[model samples]
Target: MVIHGREPDWSYVARSVVKVLTVTAALLLTLTVGERALEVFVDVGDRTAQVYGTAARIANPDKRLSHGYTHSGRLPVTTFTMRGEPRRAGPSDGTTEYKIVEGLFGTVQAPLLDGPSGSLADAIDSVEAKPGDGRARATLDGLPPTLVGVGVVEFAHKMTTEQLVAFGRRHKICGGDDVAYIYEPSFYDDSSDPSSLNAIVWNRDMTREDDWAEFAYQCETEPERALAEFRRWVGLLDENDDLEEFELAYGSLKGAADEGVTYGLVFDRWKLADLRKLLDDPDVGTIHLADVAFDLDTWTG
Candidate 1:
């Protein structure tokens, strides 16, 4: 009876074991393939949405107008690591490693002007060089030959006259070629307090004595004037109330020097959107804002 048990159906037992193993292996392979495909699809969809969404937002005029407000918010941080090794024959020695951390909401895009011609420097130069005779001929003489040859001042004059003609030709202000508008955001300090809204004008046409005299006059006579006045006359002010004392900073480069001063401001996402809105307004005319730094990393770097 024991010998009969050992000889029965050995082939059937082998086939059953093989079938079970094949089924289990096929199921595991299918799951693995499905998971990989899902991961790829999700990644692609997310990237496409981010790129397209940002591009669309920037292009929309309603979203791009400038609003005067200080940004005060925190953003999510992303870290990146880079590693590099020098060539064997190179004079430099070792591997280079670096890390970069970026904040998302710290970046803001503000509109400067409606068109490329609304450059702040050009506006200032035009105002400073224009003769009292009400002709831009003197301004043209002071400009570089290249600029004069290209008829930048002539074009500016023509454009100014045309704008005046459209704005009822009579009772229209004519000398706007010399005026420049600038918007700067910075952390407020007691020394250079944002609350004490004031305009800093460098009247190149004014003699040094006159310029100093005018500065003194403004410092004393209108020492504590509102930012609105400053904005209207000189075209700039640190006037937003949402900004706190330590949240804003600013500085400017002297001439064409590479180095410039920088200031910090509290980050605000909503205010940044408002700034874009101001720039997009058609009635604002040729407004210009300069020294805007949206990329915190670049500014800090």
Candidate 2:
């Protein structure tokens, strides 16, 4: 097409061609920008949501201990609960501090257990011994001025929340001389049925010595608070469509208000004598030790 009646002006033709090229470039640039925006906001957002759903499950494969997840900007951070366990494996020199981060992830990446520090395998060692008075007496000699250990006390059968709390009171599982603070209780129903054993731990938030002491006190005086917390977890699980998790949580919560729920108690922190008492109890079916750490400040810090 000719812009003017005169024979096509070369300079005019050149200007028209340049304008068409500029328009095409602009349209392409806009489409590219739109596609990138969609990828970042929509696609990344959906993947992050999926990460949130799987984070807790992946972090806590069996639930003998407590696990939780929270977001840090775009990153998902998962925490495994331990009372005074070292953050990473190291000598009990005063310098080591306990860390809670169990899983950290990116939108497209799987949740990773060990970060730069070390593998959890290196950190948490299984403390093995048959549960009995002999093991209890053996623990008394090695304990430090201040120490933390994870121990599991399995009962012959499932006990209601009331029974567990009463058991705590009867054993005097509180922080003080000759007594160890019960940091949190791991509650599970299908523990005997190894095929589907799932447990839930309560109150990983008690990070400080006083926090644990107070929790131990609450276990005796106001067990209802723990029951309430269990119910709250059930409610939170109800909001999601994860039927497996919901059923497990709900099953634990069932006896919280009425009788109680749990076949055993997983103790996060134990004193020399406290471990002894649990081991000596005829009602306790078995005791599983996870690991121990010396120096309380490092854990509380």
- Locate the minimum summed-lDDT window of 10 residues in model 1: 260-269
Residue-level lDDT of model 2, residues 54-95, one tens digit each, is 223323322221222223344233322221223211243333
Q: Residue 14 of candidate 2: its Cα lDDT?
A: 100
Q: Which stretches in model 2 have alpha-carbon errors above 4 Å? A: 1-110, 113-148, 174-198, 204-219, 239-259, 295-301
Model 1: per-residue lDDT, tens digit, 260-284? 1111111111112223332233322
TM match of model 2 to true structure? 0.44
lDDT value, residue 139 of candidate 1: 37
Cand. 1 TM to true fold: 0.18
* Candidate with the greatest lDDT versus the true structure: 2
Residue 232 of model 2 has an lDDT of: 46
True-vs-predicted CA distance for residue 108, candidate 2, Å: 11
